[model samples]
Target chain A: MNHVTDLPLWVAWLVAAFLFIGAGLTLTGSFGLYRLSSFYDRIHAPTLGTSWGTAAIVLASIIYFSALQSRPVFHEILIGIFVTITTPVTFMLLGRAALYRDRSENNPEVPAMDLPKDILDKLKLADKTESVYLESGERE
Target chain B: MSATILLWAITFAQIMLAIAMVLALARMIKGPRAQDRVLGLDTLYVNSMLLILVFGIRTGNTLYFEVSLIIGILGFVATVALAKFLMRGEVIE
Candidate 1:
């Protein structure tokens, strides 16, 4: 509150801009979280916030504080790094968990683990082709 | 001129983040299933962390940075454990 004015002309504007963008992205992600139709679709929503949203705000903080205090304030980068790394892990695990739950419950809407006939046929064809290539090489 | 703009911007940002948190809360409470609830909780955690960071910026305190970082760590651990629980009936096995 007291120190915000101490920031120079350009720094103030930069910080303000970054903060606004970050907040907007986060809000939009939450809206997606609320509006999306399915759990799987909803899983993709928060990534907007965790990715650029976190990065923008942290960048603003770094710029504002580093300039204000006359030294680089870099610890915020640690948070950015941590968020970027962990978000994927959590989301992946959550998605897999939901899929496992759905499969266990025998939910018909979910496609069976067994591939469709077309894909299975393609794989079988490929297997046969590989065996034929091996036999041809042996004959040569 | 810029000071007032900056103040207004900070206030605006805070309001937006608060709205995001509320939306996340709504999803968490209105969940059709456990996974949705867990996802909502995760989003809520991230929104709150952002809110705290904004608060830190408003007050010009570095301490909020540390607080936000800790919140991030806790949220990740919590989400992972909850997700694991969802996958298996038990956690840690």
Candidate 2:
């Protein structure tokens, strides 16, 4: 707590503001996760936290540490970069997985496959609205 | 004073993050599908990581930076693996 006073007033204010915004966004995101009606809708919620929610807090951290240490501490950038690069990969994978599962179960809400009719017949999926094509690829 | 303001702000932020984590947990527990649960778990990992970073800022310690970074990496790996498992019915196959 003693070290808290060593921070200048303006820096303190800036950090506080960033903290509030970041935390608020994160809370909203999580609340969305809890309240969303479907898996696909819920999937979009956490990105709010992973994106700007993380950026705000990391920015605040960079500011606080840089001010406290009297030098530009930039190591926090690694977390930012790693998160930015990895988030899309995870989200894409999750979405694809969900889509695959839904199609396998013959779910009607998901979009239809775009393959030509010949391929759909060869795969024994001509009667189905969507497919388990990816599953067939795996089996073969 | 600025110190008091920052302290209260940090405290409030931490509390909010904790609540966010709980909300995520609720989703995980109430999920009707495995994908929903995995999504909630991913959100939980992210919220927990941010909470750790805020904790670092409060203590003025740089070590927590490494800890949070590791948490992020682990979360990414865990989510990816879980997603793969969902897709293939096996993580390594």
Candidate 3:
């Protein structure tokens, strides 16, 4: 509580700068999620927050705590590491799931799997319709 | 002056994060597809976690970090499960 006043001027400024940067990036990512037109396009937006936004804020926290407590306090790194490891796994799984769902439904907009002809034949997926991407000459 | 600046910055960051959470919620509610909803939910989770961390900093307490960490873990698991369910139409298959 009162630690805010106890913090040195330089530390306070540094923390404030990081707070603005992290919060701004997170807000930008969320806006992209709300505004993007397609699921595929939207998938890339959250990473801005998940990666650097979280990092900058966590860095600020580390600096704040270490400055106040007079010790190296980095337990926040646990959140950082856990998030870094898990976000890609979740997003990749979600992306693959979305792709599979779209492909199985024969959605014309999604690209066909780019596999070798022999592999496609062996998998019995060779008869799938060609993707209508550039053929339509207009992006969705 | 420094204390006032830090205090105001923390307040502003919290407000911004809360707004981000609301925007994510809007996407979740307005999604045109299941995957979009799931993605929005994921973004919501991240925003809330960041908000919690900021709260911890404001109060000078490390306990909120653990809570935020737990939230991240649970959110990741929930998202993965939902994605699995979407992919195969089943969660445990």
Q: Each model's DockQ?
A: 0.70, 0.89, 0.84
Q: Which stretches in model 2 have alpha-carbon errors above 4 Å?
A: A116-140
Q: Per-residue alpha-carbon lDDT of model 3 for A44-109, expressed as tens digits?
A: 998999999999999999999999898999899888899999999999999999999999999999
lDDT of 2 by residue, B1-93 (tens): 988999999999999999999999999999899999999999999999999999999999999999999999999999999999999999997
Instruction: List TM-score per model, in order.
Output: 0.88, 0.90, 0.90
Best by DockQ: 2
Tell me the tens digit of each residue's lDDT in model 1 across A3-74: 656668898889999999999999999999999999989999999999999999999889988988999889
lDDT of 2 by residue, A1-140 (tens): 68877789999999999999999999999999999898889898999999989999999999999999999999998888898899999999999999999999999999976798788687676346345766666689
True-contact fraction per candidate equals 0.83, 0.93, 0.88
True contacts kept of 3: 0.88
Return the TM-score for candidate 2, rounded to 2 decimals: 0.90
| CA shift of A84, model 1, Å | 0.3
lDDT per residue as tens, model 3, B1-93: 777988899999999999999999999999889999999999999999999999999999999998999899989999999999999888986
Model 1 residue B38 lDDT score: 97
For model 3, the local distance difference test gives: 0.91
Instruction: Give candidate 1 misplaced runs (Cα > 4 Å).
Output: A115-140
Is model 2 an incorrect, acceptable, medium or high docking prediction? high
Q: Cα lDDT for residue B15, model 1?
A: 99
